[model samples]
Target: MAGAGGSSWVPWYEHASPVLYLEQLLGNVLKEVDMPLEERDAKLKFADRLQSLTQKAILKEYPNTHTNVALRGFGSFASGFALKGSDMDMVLMINGPDKEKLNFKDIANALKQSFKADGLGVYIISNTRVPIIKICEKPPAWFWEEQEKLETQAAVEASAFKAGDGKNVVGDGANNSETSHSMTNAGVSGEHSSESEAEDEEEKEARLRRKRVTEMANKTNAPKNSKVWYRERKLGKSDFPKSDAGILCDINMDNPMGLENTHLLRCYAACDVRVHPMATFVKAWASRRKINSSRDGTLSSYGYVLMVIHFLVHIIQPPVLPNLQHPQDWPGLQDLLHDEQSQFFADAINGHWIHYVRNVDALNYYGSKNISPNTMPVGRLLTEFFSYYGDPISGGHSWQGHVISLRTRHGGVLDKGEMGWNRATSEMVNGIEVRQRYLLAIEDPFETNHNVGRTVTNEGAGVMRREFKRAVSILRGMIGRGTPREDLMEEWVDKVVVDEGGQGEGNVGRGPVATDGPLSITASLARIGM
Candidate 1:
């Protein structure tokens, strides 16, 4: 498929091939939509600060307590796949007897009080299934005042520098400099006549006055620093209903499985160069199709990540990644250790489940291997991933029909019998009763009994499969015979512009999707077919 350019050179499928078009498409989409590095860094830094402040709050609440308080993140932030403005998920670990004595409700109350005392925004969602304190920091009055002062000083300095160069900053005659100075601060450039200058000044004054009024009204209506303040003032405090010390709390701080899973996913990313890009693209794609939230009866981002890892480990020929938890060929001869799977996740506490991954062993084994035989272009892998998950309606296997397990390190189908995942069996996972739905079985790498895909409904799964086929159709068109890549890209732009807000039912608060119908991509490919 050579273009107008002259060449004795044929396209190399892996390197200098037509697949490069797909690569560029994915890269450009990611660059335009994904979170920037600076934003990610700033969010991470803020998370760190929040964590530190939370720990200090706990210590302040209990000065003489010997309990060990540790705050660890567990969501997209910890997993390194965070998008722009993703919420932070943190687990406050209270080890020692304090965990038993100080319940989640108590901790939530203490945290709320402490955060509010510092004027930080805090919402304690203790009534939910998982109690969590959502925190955000707003600029205090002094902070905004300081920023305004800095901006004014910089603007004055710039005006003075211009004046020293012997140029009159033109504006209204008497208030010319003043108007020009204000205009400069507002990032307006050009000379203004006297009448226009007066109008601008009046508008600016009105805006400032309105802003001050709004600030004053907000301050007047602000909540008291603590509940005790209302009590001290005797301001309707007697009529207020009293809350129990630890009522309606749902968070399980003692459990570390969620945090450990985040670590495992991060380790997978660290061990493989392709994992991050591939996972990110898939997550973004799922978001675009509106199938990334478990709360809405679809798979979570983590579930999609597990699927990518499974494909890399088992589905692809020669396997791009080796199974880190595989118990094959003992590297360090701890002679006592016989079985691999059992030994890896056998840790527990007080009959409660605990998982500890041998990160060092996993990294050393998989990171060092040369998988050149398995190496494929990222574009092809992405294409195959969509095709595999979104096989046509006359399907051999779809995400809804079959389970994707990373535990199946060896290439083949894994039956439900092997893993013992079904409705008949039930187990207490981190203090919650978990039963296998067999709907979209994704075995938790560490907590093997837990099904991360239990949230995926039949409808959600169907939507995801259809979207997969749709993506395959789109990509195939771009690489199809006699189709110019630029023409296809232009079509993509046009399609997005036209279909901006009209994405079909069950699609709201999600990334973009195409309303285009599916065509035959799997039938056309000769070398590989899902």
Candidate 2:
């Protein structure tokens, strides 16, 4: 009944601390932007169905060579930072074939043909370093139902086998006869006849138990509506068409590093409950400001997430998050470092060592220890975050000639010149010359050679810098005026529209200024030296 800011018309400055008000505002925004539980479950189920269909299609196409195929979800979806309308990032692992020898084009073509009749849209992108197949729509309901049936049967068979001796137990009359014929072929005629008869009786009882279980399952799990009740119950969705069909998925054959990074982020997120909400809020803010697209020469969502993590881990006092990748920081990881069998062992990917503390349970409450606990509210942390990156004089990070490296245990800042990413360079990509810039260098945690901010162009970097400054200015103006939390949030996320006459300063325009009273807002910002 009360809107996001509450029922009070009075400004927050009149009754509460501005920092507290800001926190309440951020919490409200998260409530608005956070993905609903039903939606999250639906997307996960869609991913499962997609993986199943992909494995089935690949195996059917290359029945002889391909032994098994597996699809793994990664990126935001896997890392628990996914928001509404987020696309699914997945990696496809193919067994029983040499990865280099496998033709990506052939595999893509085969998949396209297999899913053509199912009304699924598939496209192969061959121009990139790693060829990928993109699925634009959810598979038909029948496809999902087919996979569910196979899973149920496999589960029943496994249960029945486990109930008996570990040997392969056939549950049908034809298989029993075949087993008897096989025993006869093995020359078991004289004294072993009694043993064979006893074995037959045991197999018959096992078969009957399996039959009863299957019948009970069929009766209880039968679909009442057009949708399968089993899947609906598992996924917590009445129907899957709407929530699942909007998910765009990309399937790549080789991306072990991506999967590893996804797991690392997931571990970091699990360490602190606040980590996810902070990262998600930053991503949403960047998206609203139009600075989160890497394709158009700006920073990616992944890059923004790294920035947030870096702030919490290195910039803030006592640290809100520990550097999970640093073994020295986490003493529990020392023993696991040398153990090759342990999950903490370094994985060699493309000449880079990918190592991190995989045991999240051990790292829980790492930041809030006896020495100095970082129990800052999310609102205050956010304000500090914006100030640290946006206002250099106010102890913000100096992005110029520096790189944000989460792998570095101390301060998380690396010299761009030392990392050899200070200057712009050009390389051949798909037989075409592409220039790589390090204007906003943010190193990949595992792939030390890769700069996540290489996609940012000079103009894009300027645009991002201006956005940061504008955010600081708006916060100062709103807080100075004792604006309501809801109003402050609205002003922070409102898009700046430049006029067609090109009369604005650095893309600032007359469109959608901070508040209704432009003069008071400008005066407040000027007083803060913005």
Candidate 3:
């Protein structure tokens, strides 16, 4: 019931519905992200600010223009309402056929200056990278679900999942079968199968699961009798949407597997807000460029950390050799070619896992410290991977060679932060209008490792993934039915693994030493005396 659901509005500009009219109120809506309490009056007063900020962003870029750009949807989390925290997220779109390059970053930057605040993000068409900006004044808290509830004014809307009959192929069973016969009102059909089922079985199961999840999206009686609408049926599901690569956040938060990392990222977008550039950057890059529109940059696509895990788990861990001496491994090239896990890794990492991790992590996770260049971000991950592959000290690295790794990494750059180059106006910052460097320091598992302007920190990101997965699993299992709503980061932080010495620094040796560099598989083996 909450969310755009299936109601595709034809942009206000398309219909020219001038229903509500009175006085044009305007100002920064995020002025109260830090505010503790916000009443209705306070929220109504902020609505004008939302209109002004959005309008100013448009006007500053498109001056003397009557051609209104039809807005399709607000940036994720449906920004464009008086959130409980007193913030407003607005979606600005142009529905015309002219595909001229629209720079969302520039517009976002301008808005930061005009509003004299921070914490603003702008995403374009869900295709291009969205830019986040902050406005002056204290604001309140807001979530993506709440936005759908208030804006659509419906408990449930048609799911994009069900909308995928022709374009989207939802298999019949948990294996994702093509022709699914089983049908459940909840949409969950078919019996559970073995995890080691054949491809056909997997496909069948996957399809049924997809439909079931979508059907379940509409029903909301699982929690305290509270109903929540769900969308993005086929897109996928996880604690963190696509990437879902969580580690340990900060040990201080507790629960080594997952705890506080997710909390910090979603907590306050007021004074400090940083995104994992890789997540947002690659997403915007693909969207702006219109690449892989079906799944976009999912874990199977752009999740940097998970990609690394796959390579280690498949290729190097149990390296597919010319012969499987023990019979358990993929012995011949033919077997390797058909290996499911290997294929998954290939589809995810694209052959050279080293090249993929090195380049993407350099940008996404920040590789400038511990043992590599300050210019790149994936500093520690590369060393770990190389070492894992028995080739850490090898100097033969460049982020080139493989095409899959190359394109994925090259696509990781955000052209200089997630800001739009053109089509952006209005600016503001920190309660005063000024310019400041966009720092991508925090780590958020939900975002790309490359995205720097996220609210979650690196420690938090690793743990957030673990927590998100745990939360989803725990809540689902506890009630014997799935409920999308789960605990926040703060709750988990209180239960982190104190043994890791907080921040999950379990003697990893402050990360890698500068002495470590690129080497060969043999050299790595020699060093480890393997």
Candidate 4:
């Protein structure tokens, strides 16, 4: 709403509509951060080609086996929050009973060889918590591979339907029994033809006679239920052999639930129109502030996403997001909480409580039924988000003492103790040490035992809070004062200097303050109820 009219700027809040300002702000932010559709599509195509090559190489190395090698997209690529040039996170799922015999080192070696042969730069980093192979860019033959794939698909489709005199057979008899038998042998045929039709007429007739004799004997020997026999035959010739145990036994691994989390975020975005822009703006802000990297002792992108969700769900005046995972009407949730695993006390004798709730359909729908649609201006929400989390110590307590949990509705806060989190104690689950960090506590929506905020250190959290406050101040100043839109928009991120318990704390009109403004620091503070 603070548009420049003939070089004279307008105050944002006093403008015709606050939503207009939010729309403009989001448009500007997205123009800077969002990847173009064409570029995103090209990158995805490159990833698919690279994955195909890797799969072919692995299969070649371990030939004549039931090894099912595939590259599954994860992380931001699968999630909707990917930026331009964001590295794709892919997981190699080697499915099959014999997959246990395949060594991860061998797989890595095969990937290395494939990348080398293609003349692409690749790094096989297997030392980390989750092993990954980093690829520089798409290979030179990527376009060629795409073209070849298209041609091969066309040929396959053409071959699937061919001219026949009167009667026709469909698919190779070995692999197409189910559909082949179901189809009529008239002029209409399937996309695939039977391989046995290529044999000499005499040999085919002889084989048919032998099959009839065998069927007669088997029918007499078989049980009364013919459907069971058909079902067995239908499922018998699966490509991947079954293991003795029910489990896949491929590396005896834990499921990568990251894909599920990605789906959850995608649903949230689809349900609300405002979530994506808000998330993107926060990501850009975090990137500018240099507090977004986990390696730098701060939060990861996922951490930032969780933070945004927390604000939208709990901090807003009328909650923008519903407590999907632990809604008040969620069935069996009350009884689930009474279970021993959800109850954790220091001296409890049974076991350490690990809160793990799987509410699959909670995020299935996004529109608000509990509360009205939160149509608050995005700009105001952004300011409030920063203000709420910016202050390290507010209301006579630090953020470390509180927990940001979706389980508690009505914008509620759950203490760390009741949530089975403590800094003084550590527990071992499945040979991995689980320790709680009191710096910041963010309960995982599904896996309650896991604190997503554990990655944030004490100093790192303080820095982030300070940055948030600084952002709030700058944005507030830009809106309150009739600052030249261009001047405030330009290099605004660079102007927020981190205060080290020194001067410039609440010192208005200091670095990037507008020269003329009606609003004051006191007014901004009052807005946030500080």
Q: Is candidate 1 or candidate 3 better by TM-score?
A: 1
Best candidate according to TM-score: 2
Q: Give the candidates in order of TM-score, highest first.
A: 2, 1, 4, 3
* Candidate 1 TM-score, C-alpha based: 0.60
Runs off by more than 4 Å, candidate 4: 1-23, 138-255, 327-372, 391-398, 407-412, 417-436, 478-480, 484-530
Q: Which segments of model 3 are wrong by more than 4 Å? A: 1-45, 64-66, 69-83, 97-105, 117-130, 139-530
The RMSD of every model to the true structure, in order and in angstroms, is 20.7, 21.9, 29.0, 26.1
**Candidate 4 structure quality by residue, lDDT tens digits, 435-512:** 345567776655555566664544456556656656545555555443423321333221112122222223221222
Candidate 1: worst-modelled 10 consecutive residues by lDDT: 226-235
In model 1, the number of clashes is 0
**Residue-pair clashes per candidate:** 0, 1, 135, 4
Q: Compared to the true structure, candidate 3 yields what TM-score?
A: 0.23
lDDT of each: 0.50, 0.58, 0.25, 0.48
Across residues 191-247, which tens digit of lDDT does each residue of candidate 3 receive? 110100122233334435434533443242221211111111232111112222211
Q: Which model, 2 or 3, shows the larger TM-score?
A: 2
What TM-score fits each model? 0.60, 0.67, 0.23, 0.58
Which residue pairs in model 4 clash with each other? 1-21, 160-191, 171-192, 171-193
